[model samples]
Target: MPENFAYPVGLRLQGRRVVVLGAGQVAQRRLPALIAAGADILLVSPSATPSVEAMADAGELRWERRRYRSGDFEGAWYALITTDDPEANAAASAEAEARRVWCVRSDDADAASAWTPATGRSEGVTVAVLTGQDPRRSAAVRDAVVEGLRDGSLAAPHRRSRTPGVALVGGGPGDPDLITVRGRRLLAEADVVIADRLGPRDLLDELPPHVEVIDAAKIPYGRFMAQEAINNALIEHARAGKAVVRLKGGDPFVFGRGMEEAQALAEAGIACTVVPGISSSISVPGAAGIPVTHRGVAHEFTVVSGHVAPEDPASLVDWSALARLRGTLVLLMAVEKIGRIAEALMAHGRDAGTPVAVVQEGTTAAQRRVDATLGTVAETVAAEGVRPPAVIVIGDVVAVGA
Candidate 1:
């Protein structure tokens, strides 16, 4: 192969035979893309990495537990030679060439008949970048383009038929960047987005003008709409033949009241899907340099909603049992009632001097951390003017990274 002479093209491998000779790191890296392309993959190797083995166990591809043979590429349209043995790679490449099958060699690019580009997919468009033989340059450029597409900096207008359904998408902690790729893609396809106060607002702003945006926080009933009304809205919009995305903050199951809406959709016979997000309970403390569970420091961690005081009859949490555990405690939605919660914990045998850290608006530009003892956290929170949507971590792990 000469410098910059290889022609770049996308192969439609769907239902086509593709041979992979080797289950090493290189094969592991390339197998996913081949699978995504719907290739009829035949993987040949004596042994494989755990991930590759898992794929085989899951029936994602056919695994032949043996060395590559001379006629392995007999009926293959494409082949990948990733074996570390140069002789083996050469043998596989020779077989592929004899069979008129395009082959990619990981050990030697000059010997390969094809080159796999650094690829990314966004809004049904696959972006593949090739910088001659420079893999590093290709990967860097691919990442930049994908980031632009994800952040709405690069617009690729896709015409999607609006499906009548409700999707509960978790927008992640606070940063728009933290949202999952699937969540973002669903947002792009949504006809109506019912968003809560805590989700990534910047993403909502990026939606097209024709996309109806409903503020779940200000939905007429009061500061927040009644749960029944929210359910009604989801069912109503879906019945109107619109794709409704119920966007919330953090993991939908993590104190987000997502199951209620899911049940409502199920009862109303409307289709619904849930996309999990990075919960603030763990991520917020991590952003503030606090580990909920540290080796030899805290072996366990518990996340609890502290909306109601421990002494309240409606509260289901067992404060006494929580105090007895030698683990880290992460509290959410407890800013208003921190005093009673802290006092209840201490009264139930937890150390008064236990370290506590309150992280406000975590994973965002407005993030702030206030550290105090369990006995003084309430006063510290007040003096610091810490608001809601904060995560409070209690235990020795809070001071491990201090």
Candidate 2:
């Protein structure tokens, strides 16, 4: 862990040869960031996407327009391969490592020299989210966390101590870079941190090496610590005159049982505060470039959980009304119930052919999305191999592509 490390610090790449092996949209996404950071790009691809061609024509990059060669990475400081071919990406990583040049493998996590966080730049401050495990997930959380700060919902940590209250912070969907500047600042100054199982671990690396972190997150179908015990631990730590942070995955207040912990702290006469983080309901799809609302396509958007207990009546959403509503429907943790959700919506009069987009690890470098009509979305997702912690956006607006 490192404290107060200045990030977004520009690395001088003015005269460096940086090879990018891919000309698809994924490769294009990395170009702007690298170029902005002053890397002289050498793009190697047999074919180029429109975006890549534009950059090459503008002299921002030198194009080879061919398959990779053994000497492709000669004298390169960094190499990035965003091709769909995992073998090529792996080969590039292996070669770069052997040459002692850093490489970022687009498709494999274990093969990257530098992981890209989902980042937002403002007024010279760059905020990035890292999962420490999944760079792509970090991207999603990063988007939501930045949104939380920009929307004026969270504040940076101050030196006040006497009445220091507990703030249950949400780190956003999955991106570690998504944590707020205020949140990151708070993390830097925190005396103790009690984090959730779903929160990104890369954020932990930003803390001072001396800071104490307690993993108090719950696990499903396991011998897990009770919530009451966790709440008690938070209060006890804060009462000892320490600035405590209870970190969650998405918006802490959403489904993280934050209110219960807040209530418990209040009952103990301990100071408490709240820092809102990004919620998957909106930011997840947005990261996948799917807007939840559009002028004529969707007038409203709704989000609901699909993981509540069977006995919880509130978990049962009004499918009939949702189907008839002229708006976007975003489902969190609904991958397991895709068939049921589609059936309910269709049975309740929603068009079977309504557009749908399933986004996994949205907004991160590893983001993957599958676009299909409602009638085919489930099958498409399965065929495309989309996984959990995903969002399903259903409506006419799914037809839009970035």
Candidate 3:
């Protein structure tokens, strides 16, 4: 540890209270980082842009919908001043200091007691780049450096985990381009990659030949490997001091069974991290030129798994409420149950003529799409031979271009 390093450990702001005085792009860029850090945010903006407003509506943030005031810093552990008004930022900075809370000024670094650093994390490894001039620039440089170091040895070795460390990453839908920058970097650095068969194979091909590749890929139901065996292999590889990546098709936490793996790792004393990815539940339909939500065609979108266990309570989705949602319904892994799902929706009051589209191999060069109404979608999809790893989108928006 460097002697000059006063705050050595980066602030783990998970569940911490943070207040942002602005609702602009600066705040937007920083919002994702804060949310990922687990911060409970309070955004104060007299006027919020569409994205910010959407986030507030989605419950990702608590919007005050008012001008920033000195009292906004009263109980905040940390505050960010991201407004274009320099004078307002200056006042917020002073208020933050009076409350003994740390604050960062978007335009005035000199007034900041401490500045945020450019940060990147790999299995138990965190690298913070400080340029002493611009943290944003430093962050960009850090991202590039992290990209370059994906396959190289770390500048410093990480503490050896006795139980080993594993990373469960979502490779995103099928587009190699849709994978998060972090997910791509981790893939390059991973010593071993255990990927689902449904995940994009092109991504796995990007790895160096020396990287061990194991095919743990599973299909919905016809035939697949046991989940327990997959978990054991991840543990075994990590305990061997090799970085293991359990890559999945979409956002690991979103119906990807990533939590189950993470829980197992924790019980075994192994360290793990989850990197979010674009899910086919939304991205696939989008690539096929279908908007999940529109001004009036649809106002909400519900993502449900088509792989629910027959005995599972969730298997009985509230189809009546779903039909009344005035939004789009997207089903993942539901191709096999297409007829049943459509029947349920129709029984619950959904219009038989509701437009539906099945997108297969979405986001890939070999993409296939089939458009039909709810009444005939099951038969249409079956005849079209659309397979697993496809998304079913049902709503009027699917007929927008029809």
What lDDT would each prediction earn against the true structure?
0.92, 0.78, 0.82
Provide TM-scores for the models. Answer: 0.83, 0.57, 0.62
Task: Tally clashing residue pairs in candidate 1.
Answer: 0
Q: After superposition, how far is residue 66 of candidate 2 from its true place, in Å?
A: 67
Tens-digit lDDT string for candidate 1 (305-398)? 9999998999999999999999999999999999999999999999999999999999999999999999999999999999998999999999
Q: Which has the higher TM-score value, candidate number 1 or candidate number 3? A: 1
- Model 2 has an lDDT value of 0.78
TM-score of 3: 0.62
TM-score of 2: 0.57
List candidate 3 stretches off by more than 4 Å: 1-163, 218-225, 308-314
> Candidate 1: what lDDT?
0.92
Error of 2 at 177 (Å): 3.2
lDDT of 2 at 215: 85
For candidate 1, the 10 contiguous residues with the lowest summed lDDT are 150-159
